[model samples]
Target: MSINDHRLVQCNEKDEETLLIFKKGINDSYNGKISTWSTKKDCCAWEGVSCDNITGRVTELDLKQHFLEGEMNMSILKLEFLSYLDLSFNEFDVIRIPSIQDNITHTSNLLYLDLSFNSYVSSLSLAWLSAHSSLKYLNLSGIDLHKETNLLQAVNTLPSLLELHLSECNLNNFITNPFMEYLNLSSLLTLDLSKNNFSSQLPNQFFNQTKDLTYLDLSWNNIHGSIPHSWKNMKYLDYINLWSNKLSGEALVHLSGWKQLRIMNLGENEFSGTIPINMSQILKVVILRANQFEGNIPTQIFNLSYLFHLDLADNKLSGSIPKSVYNLTQMIKFTMNDRTMAVVELFTKGQEYEVQQIETNRQTIDLSANYLSGEVPSELFHLVQLQTLNLSRNNLIGTIPKIIGGMKNLESLDLSNNKLCGEIPQSMSLLNFLEYLNISYNNFNGKIPTGTQLQSFNASSYIGNPKLCGAPLENCNIKEQNPKTPTTSMKNEDGDSIRESLYLGMGVGFAAGFWGICGSLFLIRKWRHAYFRFVDGVGDKLNVTLMVKLNRFH
Candidate 1:
């Protein structure tokens, strides 16, 4: 239980008693996450507790998602050596954040603190955090901070802070002026202020100073107006999400300078004008749906080989789908690295889905609700690794090519409300992985191809097509007309030959009888005369018989 000359034991006796006291206050009856905190055992060996090897003092306490309920006990704060503490996702009904006026000497060594998602803990004041200058990461997400004033000015005191997450914290009151006259967070890399009540224009000066930011999320706010030109100063930004805001204008042209940007989401905004063609070449995901953007979709968008997800739905884009879509070879084969994983919210099969972690082979292309026309490019099926393909509610025409069967990995497919005609490709039956399908409201005809997967969907999938029929729909009922066999042909030929023979025999017999009678009359005069006499004698005998009968009657 000792190390290094036995000067320091496994855990200090005072820290062990403090941890036991901390456990007593928590109602761990549900999960019993801290059951090992016993007097007989070393406190450092307990779950979610880590101690300094040489100092024998608890330095890290992680109790996230432990299902422990009760008011937070301040006894754990006595461990002055603690540098990391997490109480996120617990059932704590009330938590009084330590104020600078209180005895916060124990938090002097704190480097990281997370109290996020303890929903019942409503009010928050970050005045005490200003004293913890050594703190590098702080997350108070899902905690209400509406009452706090001068919040940014208070956080500016932490010179070492790198990542700050205040999402869903109700910090709308202080966000109006998120910066001070002298900005101090030059080293900050990630900042998330999403799902707040920011009803004002975007802070113009704030972006000018946060040049070191690599990740910025201000989504789900009431922020209006164009993105400030100062945003171009954030050259290091790799991910930026301003989704579900009231932001408008063609100001995205300012992003031409962001060479390091990898994921950009400006969806569900009031943005108008054509999509920018000067997008970063290395961007992996771009979501610009539900905007007023019009004009042909830039072919340059397909030039991005690394792009696996592109959502341009609910726009006014016209013209044919660019055949250059086949250039997205990376989406067909590339294996994404762990650093490239992103969370994306996409609309597929009439529902919105949030994919927590995008996988390497999971690709999507949504061009629905656009003005796009002409045949669907066969090149689109080249992305065999695609998972969702939605081209619905467009002016698209022509048949779905048989090559679509190559996309066997498809899980959701929607081509509804288009002018597409012809039979649903028989090759589509090979797509055994299809889970959601909508081909309704098209000019499609003929029986639906047979397959367990195709038939599994409801009749609605085939609705709006009067000519389409089969299992999921009503039966076609029409039987096939096959070609005649050799046997049937030979039987008809034999019957014709028999009738010809009978007619020939009858004609030959009549000719022979007539010739025989004529030849006898010409060659033999006696026979000819006898034949005439026999006929006359018969006539005379008949006449004599008639005369005798008349005489008898008289």
Candidate 2:
């Protein structure tokens, strides 16, 4: 058979409904990686296109971040063999409802779907996914799902669902329906509802009831009031992020029980009290910034052998950072940026990795913008994978450690508003990847080196230090030497020497006047004779000059 005839023969067995759906997806540019529209058999190798070898069934369809620009269409439902599908990260502008489920019902074997980062409305996709009993994983992030209060009520319909991600979807309307009440997501291991407007009082059973959940993210929302004691039951949860909200009450004692949690971010809230002492055992990353916590961190906080990132900024916490942190050589990333809820991500194998399998906790420690003082620990200079190091807006003093130049991977350094002194290190010129440098508002002196990173920084980054001069300053020649700033000496102020001479002259005149009033020495003949004899004895006598002057007059 001819090649074109052979291609036609291959596609002849596909169901008419499936053929129509595939044609519509190709028309929509959803399968954009396909450069040309050819016969089904000819287009099977296109991006996001997958097929079963024996059955010739189009089973998997993944079109993520493909920039396939168009409105979404329901035609996707016709491919009954689709067991794994991803249409996320594409520019989907509208909803697409197709009579595809009935076709899938005939096939009876579909699983794994991700329509996240698209423009589907809230109830449209959630309702459909809930009804798919065969779906094991569903992700709909950044899609603004806001159609119903009991949005996930359809979840009760699915029994095989294991992972559901609904992050950044708008779930904040007053849907009087008790959405969290009816569902039993017992098999679920991960659920994400972070970055939403959900303000409804969360039912107590929301987390406590989720016994099988291992990862939960409810950050950047309005979920408030004291954390329920019911959360003590989440045994499998390994990560919890509750950042950027208004939850308060006794924090330290309440959070220590999650013995399995490895990553916890409770920063940017209104919690108070001492940092929990025994809390170090469970975590690899702990962020407790922007709260009312106080007192020294328990010395054991550093002993968490798994810990890589520890942030405790923007609090009333006092005292030195425990030196034990230096022992954390296994630590890959450590941060100290000014008070802010850091949204850092950790991945395996970073710059500090000896073996590529080790995990990196970037931006993990932020101790800036607090009352923290004392010299920066040199041991912290070892974290070469750190991205942002902010020692700004604190009372920290002394020179920037020379070892800090070893952090070749550091991007942003903010030592501003400190009592710190000394020249900006010339060794900093070697940070090839270093992008942003802010030593501004500090007591730093000398020239800022003319490297790509330092030269690119604006003059504002070096402000408030009159002693500092270089590329940012007009008078660049002052690069000669950075002088140690002198302080005023503590000595008594005295009058000028010229003034003292005048005082001495005045004293002599007064004494001479006093003697004249008592009896001028000239009036004392014996005194006069003694003075004349002494004068006459030395060199030529004064009388000889006097006689010469008399002879000239004669």
Clashes of each: 0, 2
Best by TM-score: 1
- Which stretches of model 2 miss by more than 4 angstroms? 1-12, 15-19, 25-35, 69-75, 98-104, 120-131, 173-176, 280-282, 304-308, 330-364, 422-433, 445-458, 466-554
How do the residues 395-439 of candidate 1 rate in per-residue lDDT, one tens digit apiece? 999999999999878999999999999989899999989989999
Quote model 1's TM-score. Answer: 0.82
> All candidates' TM-scores?
0.82, 0.74
Looking at model 1, report the run of 10 residues with the lowest lDDT sum: 1-10
Residues 1-554, model 2: lDDT tens digits: 11232232233245334544544543354544534434553434444566665555667767677665545665566566768878787766665665544433454356887878765343455455544688788787887667644466676666777887777777665222566666678878777777886675556776655876777777778877777677767766687777777888776675666778777878788878888777737577787778888887677876676666677777887776666555453355454432222244321121222221224544345677777778777756776766667666778777887777788777667677888899888778777766666677778877887777678767887888888887866555632554333331212123356678899999999998998755745688887787778767864666688889999999
lDDT of each: 0.82, 0.66
Candidate 1 lDDT: 0.82
Worst 10 residues of 2 by lDDT: 347-356
